[model samples]
Target chain A: MAEERTPLYRRLSRRHLFRLPLLHSRNGKRRWPIRSAGINFALGYGVLFLISATLFLSFIWWSSTNLLNDHVRAFIETDAQELRHRWGHGGAPALSEAINDRLEQNIDDDALYLLIDRHGRRMAGNLPGWPVAVKKMNHFYELTIRRYTFTTPAQFKAYTLPHGFKLIVGHDIRGRTLLSTVITRTLIWCAVMISLLAVGGALVVRDLFRRMVGSIARTASAVANGDLNHRIALTGSETDLVAETVNTMLDRINRLMEGVRQVSNAIAHDLRTPITRARNQLEEAFFSATSPDELRTAVDRAIGDLDHITGIFEALLRIAQIEAGARRSAFTTVNLNQLLSNMAELYEASAEDAGLSLALDVTPLPSLFGDERMLQQALANLLDNAIKFSPPNSMLTLSAHPVMAGTAPGSGAEKKPQGLEISVRDQGPGMNDADILRAHERFFRAESARNTPGSGLGLSLVQAVTSLHHGRLTLTQANPGLKVTLFLPLLPEAERTGRSTTPAETTP
Target chain B: MRILLVEDDPTVRSFVLKGLKEAGHNVDQADNGKDGLYLAIGEKYDIIILDRMLPGGIDGLNILETLRGQKNNTPVLLLSALSDVDDRVDGLRAGGDDYVTKPFAFSELLARVEALGRRGHNESAPETSLTVGDLTLDLLSREVRRDGQKIDLQPREFRLLEFLVRHAGQVVTRTMLLEKVWDYHFDPQTNVIDVHVSRLRQKVDKPFETAIIHTVRNAGYILRPTQD
Candidate 1:
């Protein structure tokens, strides 16, 4: 009961006005903080609304009382004017008669009229006498008068009548008193409505702000305690912008951590076999090799195994480098047709030696700005995969053609943006959708490819190269085999706008 | 030939030191960057094999840079675990004569060392034709003749023979042959260079009474006239 009388504003100020506790304690079992948060909200809003309502009511009170007083004054002035006109026509006796007549005529009304002589004797009117405090010369006044049964506030003006007579006229103004009473009652009701509205509004705003802050706090606490999977719930308010930024940052960190774990797993899983085989070969040669030639052969085989491991490391490093896009510095305006022709010439014989026919259909097109060597390597890896996978007498096709980038998703029509599509299709066992999806992943090899000689990083390298050149690589089933297509942008816009690109080797 | 090898790893140091010593080159070893820099600046050597990363404040690249800054032009082969092309470029840009990635075959290292040594010791005048006893190669006509008999070679075979003749008495590794002769940088799983060299030998050395391109034990091939 004592707390209820203390005023909500005082209670809130003494308690939780600015003591914003952002994070809850561990185990999250405490409920007082949330309850106090609600109390604080109500008290704060109640005080704010009460102050504004008081100010607005005070203004209305002053203006309404003022208007009533002005109306009373206007009536008094008109009555005085009529008395003066009577005196001008029929002398001082006539003016006195008119005053008496006016008093009698407004007897039922709250009108008050008084005729005073030079010595200040009251002749007639409901007022006991002209109050001495009221100024005698022409002046308007608000005076309290004693009536027969009651005292009421009155507004009047004193007028000097004909031949040393004074006429003071006023109205009772009981209606102004009633109006004040009603306004005061309205003010009280307004305060009550504000209290209710403050409570309702505070509940809504407090729920929104508190829930938002609470969600952020929970997510931060989870992340700080090393639970990286936790994320802030985004209901997409204006404040969700912050959640979006934080979530993306967390996602990036999570991806990097996952990448580190995957790379370590790959290293442990992939390099262990080669190292063990090399170590075993060395041990076997040390114990069992009877001849120097046999020992040399064993050592060479062991070295070969070690070399394979090193090659894997090299491939990993190259992929990392390509992903870094450091080789973009070596970009030049490369003739794609000429580059493909050279690649064809270099690997065509090797493909034939494997009893596979290599076909190339490269049409002359606009040159692209890219790392020439990286592109060649990408093409070479594709051809190498084709040769490795294709059966004898099967043909491999390499073709380059112009392509168009499609419109945004959900569009009914296709949009054509200038680009080039280069594909390497081989006539062999193609991969399924799942394999195609994971093909670009590092150290991911198909089951059939396990028997073949590869580090399983060829496609990953190709993907890296394509991304570095701002291109995309997609693997599709070529019916009989796999078809790998690379879509590349024509020229980097920076090169076109800034004129910064210079060919690494100029050939006219 | 005199060589200075600056390697921090004790095992790698002993391995390279033993190989170079067995190859008949005088070698001085430094186990740390400080000692390596001290020896490299104080003594003259036919070739310097330096690891890009080393213990102590003085690193291999810094030492090489300091030496080059002081007008030291000794051929330096940089060894690094950093195997990417950018790393290789960085090493060469820091004045390295050649860059070799770690976990390298000793044959590759020894061959590069011998080549750098010979390249350092050779006379400055450019030679259009090279002669080793009765074996002769004409650079202008792109011809190889032994005892006044002409030898025919393919384009790649001709480039391979030309490199051997240019570094006539020096060793050349299989990797060097692949890079210099074929202009290919990737390492193949198979020993393809051996097949190409064998083919070249059938035409260049088989018809002759004496073998010219001799494969060194655990090293590489040396294009020198064989002694009877």
Candidate 2:
């Protein structure tokens, strides 16, 4: 029912008045001017110059036309008066002979004269309306004569007379009008020339801008392709804000790459020693092992050492993967209560074996978004450290609960509702403030706990995994022990709706 | 019994060759896996000691794999420096009878080779309870008794005495102690081997009138029967 919309190209061309005929003609003709930004600028300059020149020339033309008319009228009037005087005394023969002789001597041929008496009779004049239009005096009229335009004015003052015999004088202005036309054509031609020159100027500027953009694009492509070594050559002035920002970005990238290289080198160096030790131990056992019991014992102990080296490598790799932000894609809704209960069950036996008691108190917690494996690994590491450091028969308590509205961290200062907090507490050798602060550093053994067996990577791995999940891990002293608390965002559904879910419980 | 020992290091090769000869086994030495494999195939030996990683083209695993592929079950005991879980699994899976990481004890090696020999011939099972000089070990009970007096032994001490008694006259290096007693395949930075051996010596050597465990200078321990 609705009319179909016109094609965009057709509509645009129609609106621009670029009809088919005009387009065909334009295409066929070889135009010296190209219409681009450069051409537009030149055309604008030329048009402005032309307008100014036209106004000035038009003014000159109008004044000159008036002056030339006035001078020619006065000469015509003087000749007419002199002829009239001679004709009135002598006869027609004398007047005719004098006018014809004057006509032969005139150079501009634009001048015309007419003379008439009170009887309205035509005397010596090239025009027929000698004194009829001049009777009212000083009347100007534009007349079309012989396919040309002429201005005619009759002046009563230009006529002089004795009593009943009056002499009328008139002038033609066609020659002055023709001269004004010539001036107009010259000004228009000059305007077109200047406009073309402006187009050329705009083209030069356009080319310069294109070149600058091209170089920038090329450098950007190189950087995008992972050649961090490539840097953009600074073109233009330092004042260019785009150049400044790009250079700053490149500098940051270079620094980051250097840091990555250093870290990998350090890791490789540290890892090689343990791996080499594991290898040499195996060789000794193979040659001298005399009994099956001796050989089996040797192989088992080597595997243990090998497992340690593999653990270190895996921990390093996990940290790097977490830092890369690629694992965020694996995020899913996680039930914190279930996770805590499972962890408590797994670690409680190990803790008791180490002479440490593990306690778990789980309250209602909204599910969180996270990778389950990574979260479990992180929590396991934390618990491993807690149980390892705790003295014989020390209690390690793990609890998860909603950070109740009023009792939440920052209390009323926080914008959102309370988050969910899970904490692992141990009644063991608590670290000082400085050790707690440096606890998350890699391979950093606490001065007080240096005697303990650990690789010192547990807490660092926890920190990396915690930050990656957009959660916060904080360490605080439990007066006589160390407590680690993690705060994670509550699930979207249970958080904003304020619905309470059933709490899950765990036993020590 | 004739044994073929393939090792690259000169010191290790000579030490092993001497230890094998002293243990009353004929020893043939090869520097690399290629020559070792050639000699192993060309001439028959009771057992072959092949290093897992060798300097030449044929690695220990490759040589072992090639021998087994040709239906040669010559009982290879693989020796390697790569003492990782995966490396051990790979060596065993690649047709090796037994695998030992580097720096191994000569006594353990001699015992394993003897076991391998016993395995090839369907001979009578070796004694479950073994006796050397004044010491007696009950394999079933995991107990050690000297002259009708009961001796308490830790797991490691028990295992050490068992190995020493099994290869009574062989020389075992500290490197061998790390590999066999501690189950470590590489050199230990700590003097863990010496510490454990001293503890064993306190239990097994200190109380006995005739000591069986002897420390050989710059070599290893030798558990030989008393000459009286």
Candidate 3:
């Protein structure tokens, strides 16, 4: 009963568990019973397209059929009205003659005519009898009837004339039926075409997205497994931009990873020498000391070596702290003039003791917003490098000046570099071009400077601190020596283009 | 001086206890925070060396806060492996007198503990002028005069001499001087402090017949008063 109650299309395609294509016996490929992404997309688009096409065809079906039926009914009514007028003017014989004249002309090929007399006898019309279906119909009625010229369903309307005489009129409905058949065929063809197109489009789209996302996921997994060089391959499409952005992020990660590895390796490599030397000194002092004084001196030297090792660790910790950016919360406006003056004063006496001339040239600068302690450390490292490397009687110059964004000295096209330029130049044996490139890298000491009694983490710490303060560190050759410049960004300009964005602002 | 050491680590506790005892201070030890809180509240000590991460219900901060709540104004030095500046700030803000990160030299810890101890006991007298064996520092005038001969000293040198003279005969390490005199908590990675102290030494004791400032070997400076 329920199967009969359901519509024809729904009953034909009703989902059944037994009919599901879980296992394809022909190929044994075992296709999934559930709809794939392509099928889902196809169904979604096809149903939408078919619904609209059906609606359009349905409108044409209604208008064409209704026009044909209305035309036939109106024609028959006019003929009957004319016949009644003829009957009143010239009695029954004139009316009968007019009917025979209309039948003889037969303008419409599918037209029908039937006239029944008062005693239900045939009159002057072509039909042998009236249809029994519309007998109870009041004055006008329409129904399909058997006709000699039309094999399909026919439409006819009958009207009662004066004195109970009935006149029936109709036309063959094959044209209206053919018109509906043409509309329904067009609708079915359009639906089939739309379904095929939707399926094809869905397959193409699914494959495209799958390929793009697959490559990225594969690269991501490869990278997670410690293949640092892995990168997503671009397909030269709009998604390439997304791939490019991911590649940029990957590059940064790779660089940071290399930095971390370099730092750890440096910690192991650079520290081992001092540790071995200190151990050797202690052993030698213990085994073959001539006097208490010599032993004591050896022990003191060992202690000194141990202290240097501790100092390296301390510097590493401090750099880690700066890189972690814990000191940024303490940013306050600091007067650079006063700070530099005091620092110059602090280092002046030492330079003098070393027989080096210290020149301080500071230009006016706006108050900076940063941690004073960290900035002081960065400046201290630069000045310390200058002093330590400069020969006696050499002049070491330290200067500060503001540089606007468009006015990067030496080149006018530099962009967004507006900040205070603080430089320390030393007239000593300067680094070569190659050394200057990696000067700020951790534990990156020049080959010739290996014998120098210093940890190479100084400039690394300086760079870390400068970056924490939203500043930059630049190392350049000063002809005869090295020129290290620190760029501390001015406050207002940093806030303009949304730099210095804190976590609170980003999250909310 | 008396100190209460609340450290769960046996090795660190023994090391610190030995250093404090060798430095001529009495010490009490507790392995956990609850016992530490009890000892701290029940008795008076010159200073408390509390470990920040204690293995008990009451951590170092909680104990310190509880003590402060009970109106205990005893000085505390929180020791921790947390070297971050924020952690230090939090430790100090929780009523700790000082914060010293771990892997510290015994000399540094000893110096800070002695400084805190001196601060606590010296709160009563509040001396205006400090004198060490005729090395007189006029706090009001900011002058250092040795043996009736006025020593012209730079302002930084004056502050250094003043600190030494105030903490006379106590072992004042380079770290302490860097923190107390230079206001720099970071290690300078050089003997910059030693150089400044040497410069200060020349002006203060070079011409004197009896040298006031003495370098304690492998430790720090001590201004021993000379008895004629």
Chain A TM-score for each of the predictions:
0.62, 0.54, 0.69
- Sorted on lDDT, best first, the list reads 1, 3, 2
Residue A19 of model 1 has an lDDT of 49
lDDT of 3 at A102: 76
Fnat per candidate: 0.11, 0.00, 0.00
Stretches > 4 Å off in candidate 2? A1-259, A286-288, A291-293, A352-355, A367-369, A401-415, A447-453, A489-508, B1-228
Cα TM-score of candidate 3: 0.69
lDDT of 2 by residue, B1-228 (tens): 889999998888898899889978898999988899899888898899988878978888888888899899888888887655457768989988877665555666765676666566644676789888777999989999887789998666788788777667766666555555544343222244555666678888788787778887535678888777
lDDT tens digits by residue: candidate 3, B1-228: 889999999999999999899978999999999999999999999899999999978889988999999989999999998877678889989899998888777887887888888888767766677887777888888877888889999888888888888788788998788778877666664456677777888898789887788887777898778887
Candidates 1 onward: DockQ, in order:
0.17, 0.02, 0.24
User: C-alpha displacement of A336 in model 2, angstroms?
Assistant: 3.2
List where candidate 1 sits over 4 angstroms from the true fold.
A1-252, A282-297, A324-342, A352-358, A365-367, A390-398, A401-417, A425-438, A476-482, A495-508, B130-158, B181-184, B189-228
Choose 1 or 3, whichever is better by TM-score: 3
Q: How good is chain A of candidate 3, measured by TM-score?
A: 0.69
Give lDDT per model, in order: 0.78, 0.68, 0.78
Q: What is the RMSD of candidate 3?
A: 8.4
